[model samples]
Target: MGEDRREDMLDALHRLAEELGETPTTTEMNDRGEYWASQYQNEFGGWNEALREAGFEPNQVWKVPTDDLLNEIRQLARELNQTPTKEQMDDRGEYYGRSYLKRFGSWNEAVRQAGLEPNQRISQSAFREPPDACRLCGDAPDAGLDFHHWRYGENKAGCYLCRTCHDDVHAGGMRPDNDPGWLMGAVENLIRCHAKYSEETSVPAITSRYNIPSEGLVASAMSNVEM
Candidate 1:
């Protein structure tokens, strides 16, 4: 009777594996059967052990059907076929484009509606003047101004900084040993100083004299000093 029961249980396990589209190894089959027996010990106490005692190697007792495995492979292939490719992501303007949309959703929609080039970055020259000094090192240049966000996010009102200063800020300041906040604070103070000077001198002269970036000075003057 015990031998008959063991054969029945092994057959059931093999059928179940076939239905699940998974091929269980001998060790996995044994482990899973034992685990199931252990879980229902109160109702089917020692049944797993009984099967083992009946000369059945639990590991070699079950197998998934080939048809079920093939079905699973087909399903996976279908999923892969439906998934987006890298080219599709680029066409949809993901990543940086997504980030931009998150900040200025309206602008993104407008650009799309107008059929404008998605790859074209905003020209700093479009703005009448620089918003403030370079948020980084406080240097000014003839062109190539970009707004830099202290914290990354959309609609965060980034401060305009020179590329050099911007790189420094991104690098978390020159002092690797010091806290990052120290560099941020230093950059903020420099912006504040530039703002104060912008009030008295020509924007260009103030930038040239102090060797501050035009964007930083402008941004400092316009932005809330408390931040």
Candidate 2:
């Protein structure tokens, strides 16, 4: 009887894969599958393994054009009436932000590729370690400094900043409509902060690790920096 139930579950996965003409997600399996996705989880250890047994590819980014993924982001941005932030994407986005980060190196970059403005968030940034003090102002709170993403949604490309500087950068300096001088000054300051905290890391190391494209004008500009 136990073996029969297991066989039934496998059969269900196969049926669903055939019906969908592609691998079905857990949600779709639950909705239209002959057996519960949970049952497959129990029998096959996990969903992807179950898919493997059923002769389908494991769950992964579809082999569609990158533009298709960017289009999804644009569609979400339109619905939000602005570029969608990571939080907004979490709540309503069809695809996961992690996927976008992997594909585009940063969420803000992804937005730019989609021909949209990067959503700016003040008083917030991503950090690898617990922020003990602001990299900019040296203001150390007991609760610690806020992690500020240098670029929106690029948590890896971030540093700690006090609430004040963080707010200021997002509110004006980061905006494309901001004064060009102010933007340049702000960029310089942030680069200094990053250099101080990065412990002699080189520009090429950073660019290579994050898949940052540094060509033409960008390459020339970076060459002037001390790395």
| TM-score (all chains, Cα) for each model | 0.22, 0.39
Measured over all alpha carbons after superposition, the RMSD of each candidate to the real structure, in angstroms, is: 19.8, 12.7
The global C-alpha lDDT for each of the candidates, from Candidate 1 onward, is 0.41, 0.58
- 170-203 in candidate 1: lDDT tens per residue? 4535332566554335445554555553454334
Query: What is the per-residue lDDT of model 2 for residues 136-201, given as tens digits with 9 covering 90 to 100?
Result: 554665665675543455433455667776675455455445664543444444444456545634
Model 1 — TM-score against the truth? Answer: 0.22
lDDT of 1: 0.41
Q: Which residue ranges in model 1 land beyond 4 Å of their true spot? A: 1-143, 164-187, 192-196, 200-227
